[model samples]
Target chain A: MFYDNEMTLSFRAISSNEAFARVSVAAFALQLDPAVSEITEIKTAVSEAVTNSIIHAYDNGDGIVHIWCGCAGNKLYIEISDNGKGIENIETAMEPLFTTKPEQERSGLGFTIMQSFMNNIEVSSELGRGTKVTMEKSIGE
Target chain B: MSVGFKTLNNCLIVEIDGEIDHHFVDNVKKSIDSQAVQKGYSNIIFDFKNVDFMDSAGIGMIIGRYKFTKKNGGITSVACLSDNLKRIMMVSGLYRIIKIYNTVEEATKAV
Candidate 1:
């Protein structure tokens, strides 16, 4: 069987849009017939990525967060990006419990949760430019 | 999302309805914190029976509350977790600092 689908969404980098982004991605991935647990994991990962963009990239100022999703042959691909202040160091940022905003009560487990939930995750950024996170997960065997 | 609080014997049981994520966490945190302060309650029991989804933001909120409660010589506990929420809780290592109960009554009694 050959299965292929793709979608792109862009919205303001605001807190309210976090739920909208994750639910929309989960709905799109429903075509793969993912299990409930799998769907939950995907939604969690998406939420983390989008939250990062809103809090870190845009600094809760004013910007747009973009999401691109494509599924091919039981595999889901997601790319969340923001054109805001980017990470200074990708390596340190990916480390567990590493957050710049500890005063905000951040657990710094966003990247860790995404890494564990998805099969693969890659982050790329240019300081003072922007950041993009790409992740992949297989659904329903 | 709506949050209902029940205070029983100095323990505030927070009954959360709907999803817990970055979008609505601020409200939940504000509600619970203010209630805790106004009622002079220290310990908090989060009843997750009705919550369907949560993410890292939920983890942050819980940890924040836990820290605050701990400073006040109180405890933080969670009750009635679904499998998905359990997975997230375990992955985050929240079990180390927060107690888990099977039911709201158990959590309230523990406090």
Candidate 2:
């Protein structure tokens, strides 16, 4: 027998309200059986990515955040991509405790939390181009 | 998410509702620390009665608070954790450092 399942969702990266949509997607994809902890982790990670795009990428506060998810062979994959002011230095941004918005008290731990939650994280960004974050996690059945 | 704080025997009693995830960890930490400092409360009792979910970030935040309180010669306790949060706390090794109480009153009194 062969089993192949995939899911995808796309929405504007405009407001925090949209972040909640990703949680619903993850929850539904997991058949509502995911551990509460797992669900929370995925939601937070997605929120961080989307917020980064809204605040950093689309500094004008208007753009689209594309998200895609797929499940294959007991592994879940999530991709969040944004076309905006691309990152100049991905290395510095990923560092813990580094934030551009110091006045806002941003912890700059978004990428760190995402990496910690997911099994694998791959970031692709180009100055003046865009950013795409690919994350993968293994589901326990 | 629901957040409320009160004072008991000079200790701060923080009641958390809804999911305690990374999204709210920083806010919760900052709020509690600021309140404790402002109100001059050395000890803190976290009431998790209404919390339905938590993740590793939540554990990290709790451990961080424990250290903060410990350094000040104060203590921290947790109360009414849901079974899921309890298991996560156990796996994250939080139970080893922070004391757990059956009720908020007990935790407040112990501190």
Candidate 3:
């Protein structure tokens, strides 16, 4: 049950738009009165989620990446979804330092960073369908 | 982001401005690599006073450069990080490989 309002945004799946997506959501999260550390953590989580959508989801092709953010009390909820190729092994994908695109110098810490900084994270995907990442954080805590 | 380079005591000091994310990482890497490699500096120092935001991509960028310099028997150090970024770096385990300093002068002097 969301106590506060929500906002959603969608942008093309491109590297340039990754920063925009993260920053936009972080800006939208300002209403929660997040500390600097909280904002940075949220931005980092958004960056990882959006970058995953751009690189692994669409294979760096043209597609759409969507972000939804809302505040409920002192909690912040964010979901980043993409309509592209889904992960084959989410268990492996979530492993620390596990990256599918090592050739591109991917650190494989995207999911780990998000998991580390957020209070809760859930990933759901189906091959040939898409991937959705929903995460929650205690903004004012 | 704008990257400025300065030479000090056979070390390359890179001043990084603006945010570092997946998008700007390639440019940041290439620019720093060209100078660090061509000059054959014995060490490199990255100044992050102006950086506002960074992610795992920035970690990769720094590690890649660290490997390049280390492969050449050179050292690397970083200076001036916001508290938030420092926390991220600690979680990423960068402190094990890269030395952190309070300022560019300190990094250049020590490295």
Candidate 4:
């Protein structure tokens, strides 16, 4: 027997609400009994991904950020999708310490941090087609 | 997250309570550094006795402080890391640069 669990959330592209979304997701996924550090890592990875969508994908606050999560077997998958300015160079964007907005004090470590926390990260984007990031992590022993 | 600072024997003790993630990393870093510098403390002790959660941002904050304190010829030690956080810290290679102690007193004595 197999059980599939899924959750979804939509939020504005603002910084203050980013943390709220992250904590909410982690709390909902608590059934996995993730270690405290693992929980924090997952939340941080989600926060960075969502923040990137808001700050880079959208301009003039023009769209919504969609996040979805699912758990199957021992793996948890999270997807963040945005309909905004698409990435012209995904490779450049994923590079460490690379940011289009340096004046905002952006560390450019968002992608780097995301990669570090999760087991796997997949990104899909097209010029003006928006971007979608899917990340996965394992839970328990 | 809650942050408190105190000085003892020329060492600055910063006690962090709760999760340290992207949400709280900046403020924690700012608060600790400002208070430590203002108090004119050379050595520092980070009391993570109550911290059950931490992320890469937290790692960055700690590393940044170690660098800052090292530049002043000072030292930094972390005390009471929960098992999970200790594992993350180890994987991130933080233990190599910052000493880890079982108790705040031990950290204080070492620093």
* Residue-level error in angstroms, candidate 4, position A47: 3.9
**Cα-based TM-score, every candidate:** 0.97, 0.67, 0.96, 0.77
lDDT of 2 by residue, B11-68 (tens): 9999898777555665678889888899998898999999876654566677677877
Each candidate structure's count of clashing pairs? 0, 0, 0, 0
Local distance difference test scores for all models: 0.92, 0.74, 0.88, 0.80
TM-score of 2: 0.67
Clashing pairs in 3: none
Top candidate (lDDT): 1
Pick the TM-score winner: 1
Docking class of 1: high
After superposition, candidate 1 runs with Cα above 4 Å error: A1-3
Report the lDDT tens digits of candidate 3 across residue range A1-141.
Answer: 845879999999989887788789889889988888888899899999999999899998989999888888888889999999999999999998888887677888899899999999999999999999999998766
Query: Top DockQ: which candidate number?
Result: 1
Residue pairs with clashing backbones, model 2: none
Q: Is the docking of candidate 2 incorrect, acceptable, medium or high quality?
A: incorrect
Off by over 4 Å in 3: none
Ranking by TM-score: 1, 3, 4, 2
Taking every candidate in turn, the Cα RMSD to the unseen true structure, in Å, is 1.6, 4.9, 1.3, 3.8
Q: Which should have the higher DockQ, number 2 or number 3?
A: 3
lDDT of 1 by residue, B1-111 (tens): 889989887899899999998877877788888999899999999999999899988999999999889988898899999999989899999888888899988887877
